[model samples]
Target: MKEYKPSFLFRNAHVNTCFPTFFRKVEIEYRRQRVLLRKDDFLDFDWVEKGNSKIIVLCHGLEGSSQSHYIKAFSRYFSERSWDVLALNYRSCSKEPNPSPFFYVAGKGDEIATALKLTSEYQEVVLIGFSLGANKVLDYLGKEEKIPKNVKMGVAVSPPCDLKESSLLFSKGWNRIYEQYFLKQLKRKVIEKEKKYPNILKEIGISIEKVQKATSLVEFDHLVTSQLAGCSDAYDYYEKNSSLFHLRKIHHPTLILTALDDPMMSEHCYPREEVKNNVWLHLETPQYGGHISYASFEKEYWLEKFVFETVNQFQNRK
Candidate 1:
């Protein structure tokens, strides 16, 4: 493993001092904003429209809204560069309750595909996603369908590319906290879904308490998430949705940044050599940045700047 040059010293100071302002700006841009889509009731986005070309569509992780700290940070960074930045809210994430009976899953890519098509007007389209969203964007671009000419580049941050491994990781002791946190949110959504589609909810035997007490992702998916998304079972969904298998098909200029210490995912899930020969694929693994928490300073962080600088460098080159 190559040593990451310590850029955190100066960058951390700046991020710590400025992250508050940065966060405020993100809140102003993302608060209560919604972009409704025509495809599914579950689809919508939170947008911060700034520049005309070189659009960056940001997708957040599971149960994470477009207003997530990282999404906001990237929005600020991209907007300053005069780039159009869209912080897309997956189903049930935009504050306003989704009208549909279904929610989203990792690597499903429905909302991403919708957002891409919606932004077809842009000349340069760049897809950037964090965690679950990263895997989705990567998988979508890797499809044999031939990525549209407008999608100039792609970036994935701390992606859980292998669903099976990620789920297994969640079962471990320390990682169980993450599983619990996610399960709490998942159960809430399930309860909301049950209220929206009581008949369907009844058919699936979804109970709020049962889902709330679920210990594993597989259990949650099999009992509530799969049925809600119209899938057969947890295994079937995992087989169809995991993006690890699609690495070979990524043809765009793609950058994948992961941290070895991300508690949400397993170490074995990182596949370095998978896209080694692909000229467009760049994989970066830093020792820190726990699931996008790249705060290396008492306040500021070089990781955010690194992300912006790297994206800008690629954009300029393209």
Candidate 2:
């Protein structure tokens, strides 16, 4: 793996993390397709189909949608390579509030299963996920026993493999800013759901009052995510869903690329020993690059270019 030498202007971790999110924009048109998951809920996929046999399924980060900068940028990049790209919008993350009162949690790996099942008809499939979605990618790859034969490999970017350790960052230092922003959006969603489905939410043990009281992500996960996932508390939710435990069991070749300087992650995100022992898993921890930020001076960000190269290498491998 090549060492990442970020431009001097974007050397700062925070700058690398926030630059594309706030400044960069990707232009592409998508054809929307909705897949029903049970009867009450569904996942919306934004696809850039080029009539190719190879397809890539993209899973976005926390609170991200098909509209996220990374998803849009990568969707465009892969589609240009003549690969069909499908960006998944987790349950409530889609534009329409999910009919079911439940929302997405960090460890929601089954969502990836539904995505894979939908695209199983393709000749080859590649999986790429960012942040929380990266964990989901690992979760599915590591836990699922019967993945489709058409599924080729996966790439996890800026994954918080250890949810418990990463959760602690929310209350400390500059990370609190990110926590507050996400918390505000999360609380607002709870309020919206409460208004829309008071009776159903009551039965499900969620309420706007609890959401408003939760000041941090851990608290929110404990109050909402754990309850929805049927876990005892935040720690249980983290233990059951963290991708760290799943890394060793992954059967297909997968790449795990995370930044050592990512403010949202800790050393646990990099499973050096596990990857060393597991032949199918590839781990890369760059000295630079933050959260989901890998800026470059080229036409695409460093991550986009690197993922393209990585996918090509895997596709051409004997």
Candidate 3:
């Protein structure tokens, strides 16, 4: 073999190599706190507050929490800049299950709107989300209801803009890794729900064992996720909730970052000309960054720099 370059070695390293060590460091460093959004038995949001100036709500992806690496890094970055952050954990994600019968989805902007109502009381708000969280943020913005007066802008990273494309992408080659990982977590969560609501599981005629054996995200969604959550089917859920359909309605300054190599999303997910003139939407399509992977040489990766700088620029412009 030719002499291995340092960067090349770093990129492809297995076991305890640069990539593994980086993820470990990221996991350990980003501290998060569990917070309750409601008092009695409603939904709770896990939040971590940093800095001072305005409030920024950070939303985690499917089956993710406030403790995710990206959430921690972004929180630290914004906090240091005098911007406070609240990372909202979707319904059952924080630690325990949510009390309500319903959970959050890409279209259920109510929970987020509720969180924003609480946070926006003190400072101007900026919404940032990754993966599934990003899709919901976009959907929230696309809604006709009046957003809080303080929300200035929004940012979405590796968003599954088009659910139809995303679902198909997850079914292919190396992308199966992401699909499998998500399916595992989702299946586990569903089983956990089964234990809590045995009647609901029986009513849907789905066994937890079948959920565990699911081969694809769509299969799992069709059998368990949609029924447990009260949707007609996976197709109905995808069609009704996908953010891509409502992109034209986005009114705020939004920065959407996606990668061509993102296994979980398709190349067609990047819509260059779909951006309307009214919405200050910036779409950045880099060549690398698998899913939300933003590996780099310096301490700060390109995605981090782009998100921080973009938000700062937008905030300052106001």
What are the per-residue Cα lDDT tens digits for candidate 3 across 1-318? 011123543333221122522453353233344345565235556554554658788888887777777777777666767777777777777777664444567664566787776686656888898988988888888874788878888888888888767887788876676678778887777777667766555564766677777799888877776775567878887887888877788888888888665667776577676674545688877655656655655554556667888777776787
The residue pairs that clash in candidate 2, if any, are: none
Clashes of each: 4, 0, 3
lDDT of 1 by residue, 203-224 (tens): 6466666777777788998877
Query: Where does the lowest 10-residue lDDT sum fall in candidate 2?
Result: 199-208
Better of 2 and 3 by lDDT: 2
Q: What 10-residue stretch in candidate 3 is worst by lDDT?
A: 12-21
lDDT of 3: 0.70
Q: Give TM per candidate.
A: 0.85, 0.97, 0.85
Once fitted onto the true fold, the runs of candidate 1 whose alpha carbons sit more than 4 angstroms away are: 1-26, 31-42, 144-146, 204-209, 297-300
- Cα misplacement distance, residue 65 of candidate 3 (Å): 0.7
Candidate 1 TM-score over all chains jointly: 0.85
Which ranking of candidates, highest lDDT first?
A: 2, 1, 3
> Relative to the unseen true structure, what is the C-alpha lDDT of residue 164 in candidate 3, on a scale of 0 to 100?
68
